[model samples]
Target: MLISMNTCSEISVVDCKETAEKLNNAKRYSTIIIVGRIAIEYIGRAVSYAPEGDRIVLLKPDGSLLVHESSKVEPLNWQPPKSISLFSCIENRLKVKSYRTNPHEELLIDFIKVDFIKICNIVTSKLLIMGKESDIVKLIVLNPSSILNASIVVGTDISTPYGKIDILLKDEKENLIIVEVKNEKAGISAILQLKRYLEYYASRGLSVRGVIVAPSLTDEAMAMIIREGIVYIGIDQLINGIKDIYRDIYSYTKFKT
Candidate 1:
């Protein structure tokens, strides 16, 4: 049977073990969604609430933290500091503390009661795929018929003021194309990010077009795509087309050393 700290008068040895197990898995997954009672204290502040109650907290790999009290879209508190502090478990309680030197600011969070924990591997995999999409986009851009006979003439994974473009290419017509790759569902935000890159290149007086490559797009995103006049390509098609070109090589190489 699972032991809950909420029902018990005090945290038990079993509860500590459970928290340890969840925290270990959370480290492996790189993100943790924890539901429990929590308290936040900002030390040495003139006016501070130091809220304490049942809350859902998200611990990210980059040391970002978010606390939510209700099902509202916005979080109760968000902290994405420059550096992430260490997390320690003491007396069956989890603690996180952050300190700043210049401003002399310190934040402390304590988890008094932990009811449930969820390791967010879905978003973790999406992040991994986001990194690989750069390579896949490069493979797709090299094919003649893939981008309407476009060939890559510039550096890939190009850095811009908005963000990094997954793959940059120039078509036979000498028009520059900005490609943004998303393995998961493409939403309006993704389109907006791609548009930022498009505008950046367009401002340089070059003939530029933006293309969003993703597995699928939301209905609202599709409407925006058409209205925005940006090109869209399904990742499945791009991958399968590349596989077709390299299938024989893979099959032939598999039997060899």
Candidate 2:
């Protein structure tokens, strides 16, 4: 005679291990283990067969494989202080050809695409310079909020005692940031125009902070700024400063996480 016992609780450790091993080996399907509860059931994945050339890959936390497709990425290339260089990084993933001859030019191109205004502001602070006037205008349009948020205001074709001011800004402290922007080298006329704006503001009992923005500055123009204690800005420096700010913010958040 034989007796049979049937109970769910009767399974031993050896039996559980054997069952698990069998299940794992049943098929070659990849396994993804979840620790604790999460909002999403599965994370996305991208796998690449080869590591050469341009490609995009989505990945899960674990090493387990998932779906993968091949696609080209763009290459970023440019000269230093160009301000549009940030696009090169994205371009690299797209397999785009780059013709930049030096690292600085390449970096400038990338910086422009990443954040033009910040680059412009930094240029102003550093007094380096920009190669083109259109580049400055493009930077302004790319980040209109920066101009809008300024302590001063800018009006188009505004009548001023010192010719027409391209842009004007007034702060809460009754301080004015007078601006004159040109697409080419700011000549002697640019300086004279700025002086008129300064005198206009001073006549109104407002302290003025003179700013001269041009695609490029002549030696005479730069010397004038130094002698008069006015501020001269270009595009690249602004972009670099913006990048630094972002890097700092990212570092802080990463540390907290």
Candidate 3:
């Protein structure tokens, strides 16, 4: 039977033979964690070794392996995903070795005495992020006048020779506005893109204003935007506006049977 996610079992003070067999048995679909005194040896482009010390060894189903001592956040030794790991017994110690083929690197840990071993069913899910660039565009599209106090949205994703413009708007004064949306800090490249869009419309004899919408701006980008006469809309304001839009959704509660 497949173990449920987040379920873990603890084994105490097992010998090398038993520890090696148990870890190897679950290596395919589980996450194995072993705590013990160990000596580490690594061979790749460089060769290094760690003398006997208490450490934690982690093996993940995705082929990630790591060795950590009681230290900082960074592991003493590690191998990223897709690494092949194998377990075996060497004399009186348990040996855990992990390797990758492309560069042909290897990490060996010799466990002299294990404190405990914990085997867990691995669980993973996709990560979701709000307030993305697309989310910013959606915010503006749903509320045309939310940007630059613009009265209406001309359109979005308007095509150009260089790239597609994010959003086109018209201000209260009847002037066209070119908007380039960025989810994070705006930069010089963003300013340049807006300038290009402004120039594109200008060459066609159109009176257009350029605006950058982002969470923040870099020093260089802020200076450049000032020099080029561009406007900036911070995500703080956009988020406030979004809160109002999502207010009803916020009040919603799931049904309880």
Instruction: For each of the candidates, give the backbone clash count.
Output: 0, 49, 0
Query: What C-alpha lDDT do the candidate models reach, one value each?
Result: 0.70, 0.44, 0.84
Q: Quantify how close model 1 is to the true structure by its C-alpha RMSD in Å.
A: 12.8
Better of 1 and 3 by lDDT: 3
Q: For this target, which candidate reaches the highest TM-score against the unseen true structure?
A: 3
The list of candidate 2 runs beyond 4 A from truth reads 1-156, 245-257
User: For residues 1-257, what per-residue lDDT tens digits would candidate 2 score against the true structure?
Assistant: 33433321111113333423432332132221111111111211321122222212211112221222243242111112212211112322211111233332211111111100100001113553445655554554444323333354555446875577666666667566776778767877788788878888788887888877765688888888888887776545546544565677687877776
Q: Model 3, 4-71: lDDT tens per residue?
A: 35589886445777867888889888899998899999999899999999999999999999898888
TM-score of each: 0.42, 0.41, 0.51
> Candidate 1, after superposition: displacement of residue 96 in Å?
63
Residue 231 miss distance in model 1 (angstroms):
1.2
Q: Rank the candidates by lDDT, best first.
A: 3, 1, 2
On the 0 to 100 scale, the lDDT of residue 118 in model 2 is 9
Q: Lowest-lDDT window of 10 residues in candidate 3?
A: 248-257
Better of 1 and 2 by lDDT: 1
Best of the candidates, lDDT = 3
